[model samples]
Target: MSAIGTRAGTGAAGWVLADSWTMTRRELAHWARQPVRIVVGLAFPVMLLLMFTYLVGGGRGVDGDHAEFLVPGMLALTMAFGLEATMLAVTQDLTKGVIDRFRAMPMFSGSVLVGRSVADMLQSVAALAVMTGVGYAVGWRWHNGLTAALGAVGLLLLLRFAMLWTGIQLAMVAGRPEMVQAVQILVWPVGFLSNVFAAPESMPGRLGAVVEWNPMSATVTAVRGLFGNPGGSGGSWAAAHAELLAVAWPVALIAVFFPLAVRRFARIGG
Candidate 1:
């Protein structure tokens, strides 16, 4: 009855928004049937936090308190670790023909990936909240004010969004559900090769430079600064400009992989 609805239906941007929301709802409905997956995803990072903080011992080159250094790093790592969900979801859908159904529906072309990104980001937010509570219980308080803390959370989610697209593209390339398991082996090295558990300075000469330059390390350092956490300072330019790289790295990644994933999905959809 309204021109607004008719206008929305007539535009590219509006179609994408409308279709993405519909697909987002589809993902939310799936969540009810996959409660165990969400729980495991959230719990896996917590287990890592507990293991490193207590059983494994303290982080190297962590100044002031190790737990403070740990909490921020773990937050960044937790955001990244959830990429498996995106990877598995994409690969499984590709194999099971779920994506084909969506493509056949006359929906907006990018809506499928957009919806998946939305669902994953929401799941990541819940995981972050759980992680924050666990951090507080472990005596990891943010010395920064509330605004800064919020900024830290924003940066954390931004990195996850970038990683989501990267994971989607990687999963598409792998082309099967079972290949995801092998692909997962790469996540561990990518997670650890950065400055997550240990400071770059503590790593050693050239290796430390590589660690400092890792895109994940940039976010960790940026968030650490925003949260007023410890041990983010570095001798290298990349580490020094963590704030800039935190923004740049994710933007660059999305630019590269977002289109790649869309094109790859097009192949299957046809």
Candidate 2:
């Protein structure tokens, strides 16, 4: 009897994986149909990198080349910026009743969301690659070995994964496609409040403390260390433990939002 039950459970898990992969492929198919959207998403961040590196350059309290300071921060910023695209897609699906159709199918719960996230992560990796190439073109180099550079990329993607769920929850909450734009506008302040473009120590005292504690700031600081670039000049405890905060912040966000998003989706039609 126990063996039968174990096989049953394994079969159920297999369906879940298969269903998720199908949904992921469905989302990826949109790239071929809407190639321009993907191109614009990839290009916007490259434009931002060039503008900051040349047009509006100079990061206060940056110890070395500003590109060294800016590029990692920009990578972290890139993760934060494009979440609106995912949110918009989710809201569109919800409004258009695509999710309803999916729900009526014989699929595992939350598999659609899982599939959406996987697709978004693939785009994020593409964005990271484009930004990395552009950063190199603009004088940013990782002084660390390849392993450390890869670790930095890992941390950046971890942040993106957390942010992905948070956006999903918001998209569900917003419910309508038009409301996505309003909710997405809120993301910009959160991205800019970090030490992404400048050192936290260069800000006013209280604001500097706030920036230092921002999740994006934690990631920027940690990645800078990984890439052997200049970090913020802040002397606080958060600054001292950025690597810890970098991991903890994203994990904490995922813990809070992932289940919340799943719960929200589960309750949608109930």
Each candidate's TM vs. the true structure? 0.90, 0.92
Model 1 C-alpha lDDT per residue in residues 1-270, reported as the tens digit of each score? 655553433677778788889989989999998999778888988898878877654433333377788888899998887778889988877677566677776678678888889999999999899999988888789888999999999999989999899999998888888888887888889889999888899887988988998899999999999989887598889988999999999999999999898887777744
Per-residue error (Å), model 2, residue 174: 1.3
Which residue segments of model 2 deviate by more than 4 Å? Answer: 1-10, 58-64
- Per lDDT, the best of the predicted structures is 2
**Candidate 2 clash total?**
0
Model 2 quality (TM-score): 0.92
Which parts of model 1 are misplaced by more than 4 Å? 1-13, 58-64
C-alpha lDDT of all candidate models, in order? 0.86, 0.88
List pairs with backbone clashes in candidate 1: none
* TM-score for candidate 1, residues paired by index: 0.90
